[model samples]
Target chain A: MKALEQKILTDGIVLSDTILKVDTFLNHQMDPLLMKQIGEEFAARFQHKEITKVLTIESSGIAPAIMAALQLEVPMIFARKRKSLTLQDGLLTSNVYSFTKQEETEISVAKKFLTEDDHILIIDDFLANGQAALGLLHIVEQAGATAAGIGIVIEKAFQDGGERLRERGIQVESLARIESLQDGKVQFVKETRRVEV
Target chain B: MKALEQKILTDGIVLSDTILKVDTFLNHQMDPLLMKQIGEEFAARFQHKEITKVLTIESSGIAPAIMAALQLEVPMIFARKRKSLTLQDGLLTSNVYSFTKQEETEISVAKKFLTEDDHILIIDDFLANGQAALGLLHIVEQAGATAAGIGIVIEKAFQDGGERLRERGIQVESLARIESLQDGKVQFVKETRRVEV
Candidate 1:
């Protein structure tokens, strides 16, 4: 976790007061060693939940989520994002709104992958406004599965997404929690509090 | 590699004569153990290339590519796909046509991540028409980098993609080479040949 926070500070770019770009390492171009470490941290944190599946959105979340799934010795399922509303049967679908792109995209997973007997662990790269996490949670509910916990690589704590999930009694664990990106300076949360679900 | 071949025969669904759906273990719902094995296999095959980086497209390719990168102890960069032509500066972009989806999408990588000194290993889940690999090779060329080789999880040898790449003297190592999908049965290539590039 410290390595991730340090990497974020050293390589992450702060474009504005609210926007942080981690294309150098985390999302676009990835450091596999760091991703492996992240996976280990997530696995160690939520090892008690008895997670059966690791769920994440496609593209950005695949690297970290897959690594975590490998560490957890479970399967990783990534929800495919579709711009057009081509709804298909036997698929669990949810719409997620991206604040940066300012567009609504539908994320879907096959129904056969999830069942009531499964325990799901949701993972993502960034937890801003919690739209993606919420959408995944909705799909998990649709499958009649149990939500074990949510693991995030980076959380914009200044935003209300983390708070919202915690309000719903969800265990949200983030490696690096950004308190603020004000004035082009990166500020991290001084302390992390765990919410027992 | 034998494990991968067995998995395909057991779980891979032949949706049609031209399409094989591997969502059960390769793409949508991923088996991390198999993915790790795949990573080890790719790393072993391309280990002599002195690969400085591992590259792939977004979503499906991320899992295997990152695993290979981890095994190789290098960085992994996934090209971002864009439907709209944003045309951002400081980015290497290439257009890839998806035969399955019947659409053309632009895949972009940050120019800073790739350099002339880097030896890249391109990894992907499938090598069908090789449009994605071609696009990635173009990006690597634009960056003045050397493409050591390509590691494909499954190669549709019946298609011209693998042939086209091999014709150009590119080293393409595919774990499973499917010769045909006739009558909903998967037929693998009788013998595998290594093209010395």
Candidate 2:
């Protein structure tokens, strides 16, 4: 988390008070070194739980989810986002509203992937509105699977998504929680200790 | 490769003559252990090359790219597919036509992530028409970077993607090459030897 926060300070570009673009190292372009470490952190955090699988959304979330799945020694299932929903046979689908994109998208997973016997750990790159996570949760619930906890790389604490999930008594752990991004500067909810380069 | 071939034989579903869905393991619900092996195989194949980075497209390509990057000990960059083209100053963008989806999507990477000195190895889940790889190759060319080679998990030999890349003198290594999928039965280009289960 210290490395992540420091990387955010050095490489993360704050485009606005509400937008932080980590395309340099997090989302579009990823640092596998940091991603592997992030996965280890999640594995350590949920070491006590019975995590049968790691669930995430497509595109951005797959990076960290793959790393976490490697550390946890579990398979990962990513729900694919569809522009339009059609059939209802083998797919377990849910509709999610993206606050950043300001659009609604449908996400789905094959019903065969999840079952009542599985315990899932949800992982994502950013948790601003928590819509993606909630959608994944819906898929997990539809399969009668249990969600052990949620692991997020960065959480916009200023947003109500993380708080909303916590209010529901869902265990959520974000590696780095941003209190705000005002004045084109990122402020974390908890200050990080000085780290050696 | 044998393991991968065996996996394909067991889990891969032939949705049609042209479409073989491995979402149960390769894409949607991923098997990390198999993916790790696939990555190791990619590393072994390209071990002689100086691969500074691993390049891939977003969504399905992220999983194998992550594994190959982890095995190669390099950074991985996934070109995000955007429905629209925005500012192109800080990005290297290309338009790719998806034969499956029958649409044109814009894919881009931050200009800073790729450089002239970088040697990139392209990784993807499936090579159908090779449009995605070609788009990525264009990005590498735009960056003045050299493509070391390409590593594909599965190749639809019936399609011209692999043949096209080879015709262009691009090095391509596919884990499993399918001869055809007739009558819902999959056949490999090269017969795999008997393996220990």
Candidate 3:
């Protein structure tokens, strides 16, 4: 977690008050070494839970989710944004609104991949409005699977998404929580309340 | 490779004459252990190359790319289909046509991540029409980067993509090359001729 927080401080750029671009190390251009550390942290944090599968949306979440799955010794399921020719007719579909793209797109997972007996841990790169996480949660619910927990690389704490999930009593763990980005400076929540692992 | 072949024979579904769905372990719901095996195989094959970075498109490609990067101990850069709010402005963009989706989509990578000094290895989940690989190659060219090789999990031998890239003298290493999918039987190319490693 410290390594990730350090990497974000060194390489991450604040594009605006609302957008934090960690593309140099996190999403677009990934640092596999740092990713491994983040994966280990997530594994340590969620070690007690029964994680049958690691669920994530495509593009950004694949790297960390795959790393976590490897550490957790579980399989990873990535929800496809668009339906491909190879995908079968039976699928678990959910519509998710992208806060950035300003579009509502249907994210889907093949029906056979997820079952009611599975316990899923959702992972993603960024948690801003939490639409992506919510969509993945919806997919898990549709499959009658248990949502073990949610792991995030970075969370925009100023946003209501994280708070909203917490209000629902869902266990969420993030490596770095940014309280705010004021004048190109990132503020983190003080270690006043310890996160129960 | 044997493990991968076995997985394909067992879990891979032949949806139709041209489609082979291995979503249970490859793309949608990924088996991390198998994915690690795939990464090790790719690393062993391309170990001699001076791979400074691993390049891939987002979604399906991210898992294998990350695994390959971890094995290779190099940075991994994934081109995003849609630029999210967190993505930087200056990016090397290319148009990729998806045969499955029957549409053309724009993919981009941040310009800062890749450079002329970097030697890249492009990895992908599938190589059908090679539009995605071609698009990635275009981005590498835009960055003036040298493409060391191209690695694919599965290559449809009937498709012209692999043939076209090989015609241009690009080193393409496909783990499993399906010659044909006739009558729900997946046939791989005979290992008589040595495939370029």
Please state the error at residue A23 of candidate 2 in Å. Answer: 0.9
Per-model TM values vs. the true structure: 0.96, 0.92, 0.95
In candidate 2, the residue pairs with backbone N, CA or C atoms under 3 Å apart (3 or more residues apart, or in different chains) clash, namely none
lDDT of 3 by residue, A2-77 (tens): 7887888888888789888787788778998888888888888888898889999987888888889999999999
**In lDDT terms, how accurate is model 1?**
0.90
Per-residue lDDT for A172 in model 3?
Answer: 92
Cα lDDT tens digits, model 2, A121-173, are: 99999999889988988888999999888999999989988877777767888
Output the better candidate (1/2) by lDDT: 1
Q: Give the poorly placed runs of model 2, Cα more than 4 Å off.
A: A83-88, A191-197, B83-89, B191-197
lDDT of 3: 0.87
The lDDT of each candidate is 0.90, 0.86, 0.87
Better of 1 and 3 by DockQ: 3
Q: Who wins the TM-score comparison? A: 1
Give the per-residue lDDT of model 1 (tens digit) for A1-197: 78998998999888888888898788888999999999999999989999999999998899999999999999999999963222255799999998877899989998999999999999999998999999999999999999989999999999999999888887899999999999888999987645455
- TM for candidate 2 is 0.92
After TM-score superposition, the amount by which residue A143's alpha carbon in candidate 2 deviates from its true location, in angstroms, is 1.9
Candidate 1 vs 2: which has more DockQ: 1
Clash pairs for candidate 1: none
Q: What is the lDDT of residue A99 in candidate 3?
A: 81
Worst 10 residues of 2 chain A by lDDT: A188-197
